[model samples]
Target: MTRLDAVVVGAGPNGLSAAITLARAGLRVQVLESHAQVGGGLSSATLTLPGFVHDYGSAIHPLAAASPAFRTWPLHAFGLDWVQPDAPVVHPLDGGRSVTLERDLYATADGLGADGPAWIRLMKPLLDDWEGLLDDILRPLPRVPGHLLTLARFGIRGLPPADLLGRTLFRTPEARALWAGLAAHSILPLSTPGTSAMTLVLALLAHAVGWPFPRGGAQSLADALRAYLEFLGGEVITGVSVRDARDLPDARVVLVDSSPRVLLDILGERAPTAYREALTSYRYGPGIQKFDYALDGPVPWADSRVGRAATVHVGGTLEEVTASEAHLDSAVSDRPYVLTAQHSLFDPTRAPAGKHTFWAYAHVPGGSAVDVRPQVEAQLERFAPGFRDRVLACTVTTAPQLQAFSPVFHGGDVNGGRGDLWGLLSRPVPTATPYRTPVRSVYLCSSATPPGGGIHGMSGHHAALAALKDLFGVRRGE
Candidate 1:
């Protein structure tokens, strides 16, 4: 048998991304995935009914579309097509009113009414350098930023808690609600510091590149990535789980794109005691109870304008969203902030003719098994009247189920680990290069690394770069 240059465990976005990076550097790389297919979270299935394709994980991918590494790759040539809706987001309120984050900065500002000027003032500067800003933030921190001025400008506004920032900047119910909806994506209490970072980036991405998804489903994006990797001479072997070192092919380096726990298990005693302890002490935030609905028709939203965008934030006022996220450990709220994506509305490939699909989930306590279906449906019904009537079938994925699906979604905290201030800084343990494990030639490239979660794939991109430099003495752009 011949020695391989690198072996990547897990065929998720990050894993495939790592393999692609190494293979691009002219290394022989192979990816191993436990699932029959690639895309750990970027997968799709007929969970509810036949002909109704549903996304098991991410639906709308603003980050993936705008990723630095992804932009450089020719994913579109490999069967990836983006479906950009008219608007990026729509946040519905009571009284059949809603505010939209339109693709155009001026148009979105106009929709915010009196808060229009404030909205422009807050977002325009960041949007001007969205690409530079994304490059700086989508990697490990505590390093020299590529865009110093842009990062500093963002830090001023994004350092505060979302609750405080939203209330302070926007006065109108519509604008504040829109800001709250964006911030709630963090899956953290609106009062948490650094919560505004994702909020700013999401809003910026909305204007820079409309929040888009693959035309067929999330799996198409994954397939395109895998296809591109194979084009670079990388091999992907699915249905193979790497439990320990012996499970991996003999390689000069191995990058584990699973959770920190999974990495530790694979390394066993090869990992230093201190490193093991750090990973063990790593914390996870709230999990989510996901609901996928194979609907008979489009969601009958009260305002009707909600159909303009594929993504909808269905939780009323800023106060409501803040409360919903704040009470993660307690009883579920009747008006929980439900992040929903209706891909079938724009992409006919997602559902059978005339029918549609609804993807949604609400934050919950980590590892929670409580059935919050009634509460989740109630929230849906509140904004979109007769929502229950359109449900042909519903598939509820509990927090534990998400963890089982992908260990990176540990306890269903889909952002991989947590996104709080400390969680972001000390992800899987604070280090100059979190991707580098103590064991030589082994690295952690999962979302548990810096710039945690989302489908951006920067974690894997950065990790592979680290390995390329350390093992092959290959640097970026070298």
Candidate 2:
């Protein structure tokens, strides 16, 4: 093959984004992926039976829809249609009661009982500056922020521990539990600082962008992105794993959209001593065991609204969620807090006629082999009775399985690395420039970079921009 201007290792959203960005810069760019198909985490398959499409990783996409980078590309033209539900999220309590995170702020707050006003008061500022806040926080932070006031407001009120936020702002268990469940997405302990930021960002997005996913499966979104990249003259090579630096093309610029450790492994001796030590010592949070269920019918949720919403948090009260998520020392909970999404309810293409698709995941110790299915079933049956009887088929993915499937998923720490207190600001290693590695003309564009996890792909976009300005002559605005 001819030498390319840029070679992006890994074809996840971040890799695709880097390749696409470089391609848009009028450079010859090639993306190499290990799997036959692209879209590392975004890929989907019929893990159960034919005709049932399930998302392999990301089920709900609020960050992707609102991303500054994705907004520039019209992915919808390439068969990416987002199906938004009536409510973005719903947290179920006992006795047929559930709280929905409606598109309208008041509508969501209204269900919080006595803490309804407090919920609104806490979220209103972030919602008011939703776009600005995302623009600042979506990428690396502590830079000269454009919206310093908005960032300041969010940081002051949103940086507390999940347990603290829940207890202080919410008078009712329902409201507090909802916050706890959303914050648990961080995979950090509830007592961990900066955990509350997840709740604030996710909650605001429910109203700001409306939590939605592609109609067919998450893979459809990836396909659309890849198609867009190809349209821009970028090339993607599949089934080619780049383990050593010798596997990469002789390119002017190289971007690795993998974990920091994987980048170190691929480049090895090429990376300097300091950078090598930093990446090797990188910390990861608890792993997640994801379950995809092909259901005979919709989940028989006690509260019908739980099925109506796109995502559901199945953990009980705030205290209960805290106890379940405190598995930092690598313990799995029998009554683990679980997040579930019944995609077929909103997007029928996910399953066959009358049949349904259920996606759920629970936190466990990194690389644990214990089966969390019984716990998952118990959680589902806790809110939705007789849930097991409706299952036509199910597939379980442990941390090791996810890691084997995609190297970037390091120990199934899906956020690339932990986004806890210290790890949040200084992920992949403490440096003002997270994307720029020790090696010149090489960058880390994966979630291991700044802004940590999610499907936003901003890390790739930013990394490509850095490569363009620092290596090439091209540049973009601040």
Candidate 3:
């Protein structure tokens, strides 16, 4: 029986995005989610203690602030408010000395001393048309961008390896280390080709719009999206996993907010052999060993700025950061690079009064069950003395556990898939619209698509538009 016009098989940000789009276009949309709650990566819970709340998947949301798709939605009106820290990021060195990426471009430069001029010159052009620049970079490639020169200039800088660019452009260790920390977000080694693109865009995001988190945890953002969909007469069913398209209610179109692996399973024999092989051959990157801490007091950081920064890069200098990434590339290292966010420092709702919540993760070899907490804690303790003593309680989520929780984080590859040089452009498969799969009415709408990962929701938004234009003949606006 035809129960809905469309069915979204995952209620992650991407799934909800596609559901909302179709609902707004006057189609009956129903989202079926495996998890009990909505937000796929946006869910937050009291992981450590009764008072402490930690994000299960993503923590900081720089991409959300600049997403063209989110810009069109009135999510803020639906009770999604952002809370910003004093600074976007803090990179601490050996001693108490630290470098901060401030919200204001000039303020961030001021901390760089002599390299301030070079920083200003490098960032000025990008900041001028920040939104336009994001528009060009934050979507499927192969299409003509509105701003050709802006994208070309970005390509010139972003195309280079971050290691080379940092060494060539900046003289100081602080500048180079900051870039390394930012580029490490790519999950690729700093020496890799597209690594510079990750660093440039992340730094620009910090200087353009401060890295912020949703108030009352990321669930608020997901709830807001779900609420907006409901207002548009859409619905979602929880705890229902769609193992195959045949298992789902009859619908005109089905958008899967899942990884290529899950898509392969769902399609089964219905999938074309080439598409099945392509999805099967789709590469997943290194996994993550995550930790959440409930602290008795603020982390005793050597640098006071670390208290103000919502996100902290715990690895030491440029050379050290590069070495740590290389270690992840080959094997787990004792001194691993750690990406941390202490939102409870800025957002009070994350925990009870006095207690604080801290989220951190280190990249580990794919499908590795090894617990990297000791090393992660060691790294934190390296920068923040007395860090181990301050923890009231701690919770660890192994790579296997992450994959078990969400299939999209297959093998604990959180950013969807491997984002190497080719991983960025030809993610999953290279097509004008990466959303379309062999099954015409069935579209893949996950971070596995172009503009991979983080809480941007563009992959879902783009997939929905593609389905509308091609399948339903309805342009996104209409």
On lDDT, the leading prediction is 1
Query: Rank order by lDDT, top first?
Result: 1, 2, 3
Ten contiguous residues with the weakest lDDT in model 1:
326-335
Clashing pairs in 2: none
Task: Provide the overall lDDT of each model, using Cα atoms, as 2-decimal numbers.
Answer: 0.92, 0.87, 0.87
Measured on C-alpha atoms, candidate 2 has an lDDT of 0.87
The true-versus-predicted C-alpha distance at residue 146 of model 1, in Å, is 1.9
After superposition, candidate 1 runs with Cα above 4 Å error: none
| Alpha-carbon RMSD of each model | 1.0, 1.1, 1.2
lDDT of model 1 at position 16: 89
lDDT of 3 at 46: 85
Candidate 3 lDDT by residue in tens digits, 417-455? 998867877778877778998887889999999888888
lDDT for 316 in candidate 3 is 87
Provide the lDDT at 96 for model 3: 91
| Candidate 3 global TM-score | 0.98
Off by over 4 Å in 3: 1-3
